[model samples]
Target: MSEVKKIATRASYGSALVELGKEHDDLVVLDADLAAATQTGMFKKEFPDRHIDCGIAECNMVGIGAGLATTGKVPFVSTFAMFAAGRAYEQLRNSVAYPHLNVKVGATHGGISVGEDGATHQCCEDFALMRAIPGMVVMSPADDIEAKAMVKAAYEYVGPVYMRFGRLAVPVINDRPDYKFEMGKGIVLREGKDVTIVANGLCVAASLEAAEKLAADGIDAKVINIHTIKPLDEDLIVTAAKETGKVVTVEEHSVIGGLGGAVCECLSEKAPVPVKRIGVNDVFGESGPAVALLEKYGLDAEGIYKQVKEFV
Candidate 1:
């Protein structure tokens, strides 16, 4: 069997920016002195004039991005999730989201997968924060292809967007010809009669692997990739919940106010089914190897499989 290709969604974010820069002269990128780590250096290298380094001030950078947007420029503000979503929350909520500007927040190194960076850097609450903003579009791509596609979609959407990317390289699962990307839509990767596994970001791949394990154990689990979190694919989630009668949501983020929370919110009102949310259990992450932390937090394939088996 051929080895699966892996690439960090952060890398994809940078590459997509470069590609979009070539097509749109109005596209600009700003970073909070984290161009290299956030992968915005790729855009800086290609268009030095368009890329602005705001020197570690996340709030100011967001304000600058918002100001640039008023001039009909699509500005992507790049930084770690901690800074982009956490540190600059006030500026983002007021300057960008309140005015409904065409500013994209490229938040890299989201969740516990940030590894040795520890609790301070790992931003598991970004989804909840971004989702709270009235018109904000929140997204977390599963792989390189989806990440690139999401960037394009965010750029075309013309409003505030918060895009989360991971540092860990994840497998490329959406490389099929039938694959399609649409805002506020979920993709059903596998069809089954048993429980439904809805996930995003790195957890989508893990959930898919967990579904395979469930299949081996005679549990036909369905897998759904919900890349968009703000304008969530409620219909898809509701339909899947009705079909399966039980649902499991997985994410690298905290189970509170993330994908798991969003899924629960949807199912409770529309399809009310039993649900199990697999993610960080509302505890701060400690410094550790990224893979090990995932294992410890039950975000890896084996861990998810074990949890799903137990749930079943």
Candidate 2:
């Protein structure tokens, strides 16, 4: 294994868009005056004529993307998760999901990792919001590789998709050459029998580290990376639950209706297990550094280690 580099998922998404743009001329991009923040500027630089800046109007941006999709153009809409999932939610549900448009939504700065942007910008319920929309494929990539691959996958998929990207530079988790990004499939990073740690986004790296720490205490933990939130890998979750007998779900979003909730919903019906959820427990985030916020909210590796140890 080589030394891993930490990079923002938004950066990877932006680069992938540029590469995808070169191959497909109909790939259009729409941003709500947040090209730089959302990292869509890379695509805009390469294909200025194909990029559309909707100027702080997220609803309008989503509508425009849906309109473009109707015209046989693949539009990638970019904006902060707070606005993309919350502000333009109605437009997304009606114009994109309901119509089943080929529009890919790039929702950056998801969860509390938005850092100093505070509670207003920290979208803790985006996964819940996007997951509720019918025909919406919700994905949250763990690292740069998965993020980049998902960008291309979302574009290739023929329906509406919402991808969650982070503002913080998360550690590279899926750097193996053999690792492939498949929608609605979960990857098992570490195999163990005591407990299964299912996590997504930034929590995937933290869960891997926590699993290593648990190994020192003779508590073998299985770490599963669930990149796709909606249309979750139910088979993997059921298998883990049946095998491990105990499960822990980790995420940067709220514990009520995010990764933890989704896993619980699956296990409660198929294979019931004692599931411990590690995330922001029904509270808004405050202004702080990305790493600090993660630690404070118990979403970091050390936090996950403590929670998993207590659960097991």
Candidate 3:
């Protein structure tokens, strides 16, 4: 098999847009004056005419993207997750979600991984905000490979979509070029009977390690990679809850309303089980390295293992 072509989520959006733009003339890129940071610069370079930098006006950017989508254009709006989800939520709901527009909102720098940029830039509530939108498709990929796949999926998916990618260079677990991806489906990275650690984005890798550590302690841990928070794979989550009888949902976002919340909501309605959510508690992010932020907030692998330990 050929080597995997893993690109950062931001980079993937740039590269994939290059391909999508070539095939479809209606594909357009929009940035709230964050093209360089979000890697939408790649699209701007490739197709300058199709890229629009809307300056720091996030609300206007979202409105313009939704408008373009209504006019038969596929607009991929790139910006920081905080601004994309928090700053312009009304636009996302009223313009994009209400109209069911084909607008891909590519939010880079999600979670505390925005790091030194501090709390102002870190979007801990992004998932909660996006998930609350009725017609929004919330996706957060775990690695560069999956990030690329998710970006492609967002392009093809109709209606409002908020897909975020982080800044730090996380472990590239599935970098193989041949790997295919599907939205709204959780990928099973490992199988076990003791307990299930359901996670997505950066936590997928941490949970994998947590599961490994658990196995060494004679605790078989099942890891489910939930890349899509909205339209979550109910079958997979319910089955995992049934098989394990215990679960630990982890994510880089806040503990209140994110992946953990989504999983708990699912488990509560369908497969009731002991769930321990491992993520950022009610706290604002501080300036530090990405890993430090994750550790400080108890969103690391050790945190995941500890949370699972409680439920199991």
Candidate 4:
């Protein structure tokens, strides 16, 4: 078998942003101090005329981006996930999300993958924060292809969209872009009868690997890539529950109010099945490599496989 190429979501976004900017003259890119860190360097290098750098002030950057968006120009603001969702929350809620502006907030360095930066940079609560904001399309792509697809989809959707991507280079799953990527629809990667594993972002890859390990143990684990958490794919989630009585949700985010929470909310009233949540146990992250942080937070492949085994 050929070795699959590994592409980080952040890098993919940088490339996609450049492509979008070239295609549409009205499209603009904005960054808050960390322009190079978030791959806005590509845009800055190509079209310095359109790229705006609002140094260190995320709230102000968001407001400025929203203001530009109101002028009929699509503004894509890049910053660390923690700042984009937390620091610029008011602007996101009122100026952008509430009014439904044509703005795309590309939040990189999300989850515990902002390795060596510690909890200050890790954005475990971004999913919850963005999901709570009505009219905000919260999307977390599983890999490079999905990241590119989601960016393109968000631009066409015509509203405020938040895309959370990490800095690490994980296995590049789903290389096919022809796959239909409708908002609020979860992609079912694997079908099984024993249990269903719903996951998104970096954890989606881990869940797929864990499902393979579970298969070796005679347990069929279904893997569902939950990209959009806000307008969740409730129908697909309920269908998984009806087919398999067990479920395990995995994410690189906190177990408190992340993808697992979304899954539980849907299943609590709809299907009501046995669920095992795999993610950060509501704690801050420490400085370490991304893989170490994942295991320490109990969101790695081993953690997911172990939790699913217990339910089985």
Candidate 5:
């Protein structure tokens, strides 16, 4: 069997920006002294004049991005999730989201997969924070293809957008001819009637693998990749929940107010099925190897498989 290709969503974000820069002259990129880490350096290298490094001040960088947007420029503010969504949250919420600017906040290194960077850097609450802002589009890509497509989509769609990317290289699962990318829509990867596994980001691939394990055990699991958190594909989730009678949401974020929370909120009112949220359970992550941390936190394929098996 051929080995699966893996690439970090952060790398995809950088490459996608370069692609968009070529097509749109008004597309500018701003970074908070994390161009290299956030992969915005790719854009800076291509368009030095359009790229702006706002030093280490994430808040000020957001302000600059917001200002640029007012002049009809689509600015993508790049930084670590901790800084972009956590540190500069006030500026993003007020300056960008409040006024509904055409600014994209590219937050890389989200969740416990940030590895040795530890609790301070790992931003598991960004989804919840971004989702709270009215009219803000929140998204997380599952692989390189989806990440690139999503970046372009965000640029084309005018408004405040928050996109989360992971440092860890994940497998390319959506490289099929039938694959499509649509904001606020869920993709059902596998069809089954036993239970529904709705996941996003790194967790989508893990959940797919877990579904395979479940299949081996005669537990048919329907897997859905919900890339968009805000303006979530509630109809898809509700339909899946109604068919399966049970739902399991997985994400590389805290269970509180992340994908799990969003799923629960949708189902409680519409479907009201039994749910199991697999993610960081309201606890801070410690410094550890990224893979090891995922295993420890029950975000790995084996962990998700075990949890889903028990739930079923």
Candidate 6:
């Protein structure tokens, strides 16, 4: 094994916007007073005229992005996950999803990894909220590489898109040159027959590590990275469940109405199996370091390993 490179998905999001901006002239960026934090400042610096600062009003920012979309502009809205998905959910529902506009919402600081920001800033239910909207494309990239690729893919995709990224730096798991991000498709990182671990966003790396731990114990666990949550890869999920007869879903969001809920919903309808969900167990987050928070909430590699062992 070699030393892996680590980078924040938020940083990758900023650079992805700058890279995509050069190609798409209609691409416009919007932020609500936290461009620096969300990393949308990179786009603002490069394309000043195309960027809009809507102050601290997240709702107004989303509305502005919706309005821009109506005029044939591709607007990428940026803000914290709490505000983008919670505060401005109404505007997103009406202005963006209702009309099926071409708006890309970049929600950073998603999940408990926001660290010292605490419960208020840490959004563990954005995935659930966003996925409920009709015609909404929801995505949570696993790492920087996937984050960049998803950003570009979301821009090219029509209608509304909600992309969640984290503030903490994570190891680059998909550094292979052959890697390509396809919308609504889940990528299998490792193949096994004992169990299947389906994970997204920050938990993907953790799940990979858990798989390695399981392998050492003679438990061959399959790892699947679901970058796109909505329009989830149903075939993949069903196949994994049918093949393994056991399934585990890991996420940084709440166990309710998040990836776990989505997986259970799919399995119940298609292939019923004993599924274990690893995430925040219907509780609010507290102030702590990002990694510590993950550990306490049972969202880390060790936590996942324990949960999977118990589940099996």
Expressed as tens digits, the lDDT of each residue in 1-312 for candidate 3 is 024333456776677778888888989999988888898898899999999999999999999998898789999998999999989999999988987888899999998878899989888899999999998999998887788778778888878899989887677787666566888888889999998888988888888988887888899999999999998898999998899898888988888989889889988999899888888888888889988888877777887777677668
Better of 2 and 3 by lDDT: 2
Expressed as tens digits, the lDDT of each residue in 1-312 for candidate 6 is 237788999999999999999998999999999999999999999999999999999999999999999899999999999999999999999999998999999999999999999999999999999999999999999999999999999998999999999999998999998888999999999999999999999899899999999999999999999999998999999999999999999999999998999999999999999999998999989899998999998888999999998899
Candidate 5 local lDDT, 225-306, one digit each (tens): 9999988999999999999999999999999998999999999999899999999999999999999999999999999999
In angstroms, the error of model 1 at 102 is 0.8
| Per-residue lDDT over 13-106 for candidate 4, one digit per residue giving the tens place of the 0 to 100 score | 9998988887889889999989778998998999999999999999999999999998999999999999999999999999998888999999
Compare candidates 5 and 6 on lDDT and give the better one.
Answer: 5
lDDT of 2 by residue, 1-312 (tens): 125689999999999999999999999999999999999999999999999999989999999999999899999999999999999999999989998999999999999889999999999999999898899999999999999999989988999999999999988877788999999999999999999999999999888988888999999999999999998999999998999999999998999888889999999999988999998999889998988999998888889999899989
For candidate 3, list the clashing residue pairs, or say none: 4-175, 4-176, 4-177, 142-201
Which 10 consecutive residues of model 3 have the lowest summed lDDT? 1-10
Residue 30 accuracy (lDDT) in model 5: 96
**Cα TM-score per model:** 0.99, 0.98, 0.95, 0.97, 0.99, 0.99
lDDT of 5 at 216: 99
| Model number with the top lDDT | 5
Better of 3 and 6 by TM-score: 6
- When sorted by lDDT, best at the front, the candidate numbers are 5, 6, 1, 2, 4, 3
- Clash statistics: count for each candidate: 0, 0, 4, 0, 0, 0
The 10-residue segment of model 2 with minimum total lDDT is: 1-10
Q: Report the lDDT of model 2 for residue 243.
A: 95
Query: Stretches of candidate 2 above 4 Å error?
Result: 1-3
The candidate with the higher lDDT, 4 or 5, is: 5
Per-model CA lDDT versus the true structure: 0.94, 0.93, 0.86, 0.89, 0.96, 0.94
Per-model RMSD to reference? 1.0, 1.3, 2.5, 1.5, 0.9, 1.0
